[model samples]
Target: MIKLIGILIVVIGFILKIDTLFTVLLAGVATGIVAGLDFNQIFTILGDSFVSNRGVSLFILTLPVIGVLERYGLKQRAVSLIEKLKRLTTGKVLTIYMIARQIAGALSIRMSGHPQFVRPLVNPMAQAAGLSNSDELKESDEEAIKALSAASENYGNFYGQNLFAGSSGVLLIASTLTQFGYNVTGLNIVKASTIMAVIALVVATIQFTLYDKKLNKSHKK
Candidate 1:
């Protein structure tokens, strides 16, 4: 059907590596025209869809603010703050953050996350800690530290959130089990989640300790 022309346009545009937003908008407009909709109708449809899913665009609002903060030395300040703590190491910093993240998530206090917290603050601080006693960090080593910081947030959130009584994960588990003919309760899910979180914390602590040892040995050489 001619109406399916938009799908072909999207596939071609992506394969050609065109700008994603422009490609989608062009495809949508073309599809509307082929379906006998005028420009006004097409524009109205686009506006309504955007309004319904505006939450996805929420991150755009934060980018400018983050850029302004960076321009004002936000990352440098984070690094400087970490450098003042002579005994902190990259592994120790991330491990502490992981624990704090897990605890906060369990309490349903998700004020810290990758974009809002880790990128703007945690990654820089962790990098500074790694570079504190060393001559310089290799590009690979810097990237590894950033990767670990991001992983810490993910690990903490995954295992921790279910501990909250009203967490969506608990509901999903209960709902899924019910669908499968199991009468699982929220309290049971919370109990299981809490146990899993404890195990995760222990494993994370051990990994961090080993990583710290490795970093120290490398710095000494």
Candidate 2:
């Protein structure tokens, strides 16, 4: 019963619009105290969790760098580069990025496309390509294109990461199955992940192509 205090604290703190990091830490400390844990022990657990999920920490560094780049015309540069390629439509640009992202994931390369690429590069490229074929881009069209651009990164990362034998997802799946008395290995998960990634790529390719045709038709009307 006492251990559930953390959830209550978080809910209340969030509702009050409190400082997020401070609220969470306060909740942790309160919960630890109630659960008979000393401050040192509670901090030890938090520190361990932080260390294990270092990816989240890297974003702290990457975000400011990305912000600095954006301030200096990173997005403008991407749009300008894409505008020079007269034939590449919005869908085609997104498709190419999706494929590249999938391959990077499969090879165990860590690429956080939303922050590192999509927001600053792919989305602008897509908008430029959209403008090339349309007389005037509507608000609805812009929003739709943004959704599709974001989805491309999600599809690639979600389906392709497990293709790596050492991916956390693969290991988790294998371990969970083994706990249930099944004999599954990370290699087995990787094999299945490959098939899923292929299917996803094929499906995404069709979707992007169809979108281009539809978008072109609508613009011509």
Candidate 3:
């Protein structure tokens, strides 16, 4: 039970607004010591874990490039492009991106949205479209717009990935069903996933539309 201090450490670190990476590393070292691991053993385990999941860090490489592009006004370009389409409301922008993301997922094309696209491109575009008026936004409205921008990426990624026949989620489902003596194929899972994806898209579209209405309502009051 004392070994569970790692979780406690994370909670305290976050509450105190510590550097996230340093806090996690400290927590890890503390947990290792409590578990009777020598310093060398703890370092070795950390190294092994890092190596095993290094693929996740690959995105970090894109950060410098993204930063450079943003420094050159990439986000401004995106905002300008979206603003040109007079009919493109904030909700419409999100809906369109969600649709594109879903289609890309169906084709097994990876779109690393949050940092590469959403933060640098989509969020700014949404903010521009969301402004839609000369009036400033209430803090809640601003937060909602940001949340919706992120949610659009999440919705598309989660529901869209399942549509691919070769996606890990589809394969896992087929394999798990086969283990339970139920014959299933990735293609079959994907077929069903397509319907679910459509349903999810519909739901997201409705939410986006309503959010737009809410924004308009807020501004009117």
- lDDT of each structure? 0.87, 0.90, 0.89
Q: List the residue pairs that clash in candidate 3.
A: none
CA lDDT of 9 in candidate 2? 95
> What TM-score does candidate 3 reach?
0.74
Q: What is the TM-score of each candidate against the true structure?
A: 0.74, 0.78, 0.74
lDDT of 1 by residue, 1-221 (tens): 99999999999999999999999999999999999999999999999999999977777778788879988999999989998998998888988898888788778885548778799998999889998779788887788888888888888888888888788888999989999999898888999988998898888878777877777788788
Candidate 3 residue-wise lDDT, 145-179, digit = tens: 88999999999999999888888888899999999
TM-score of 2: 0.78
In terms of lDDT, the poorest run of 10 residues in model 3 is 133-142
- Candidate 1 regions exceeding 4 Å error are 1-53, 110-112
Q: Which candidate is the best by lDDT?
A: 2
Better of 1 and 2 by lDDT: 2
Best by TM-score: 2
Arranged by lDDT, best first: 2, 3, 1
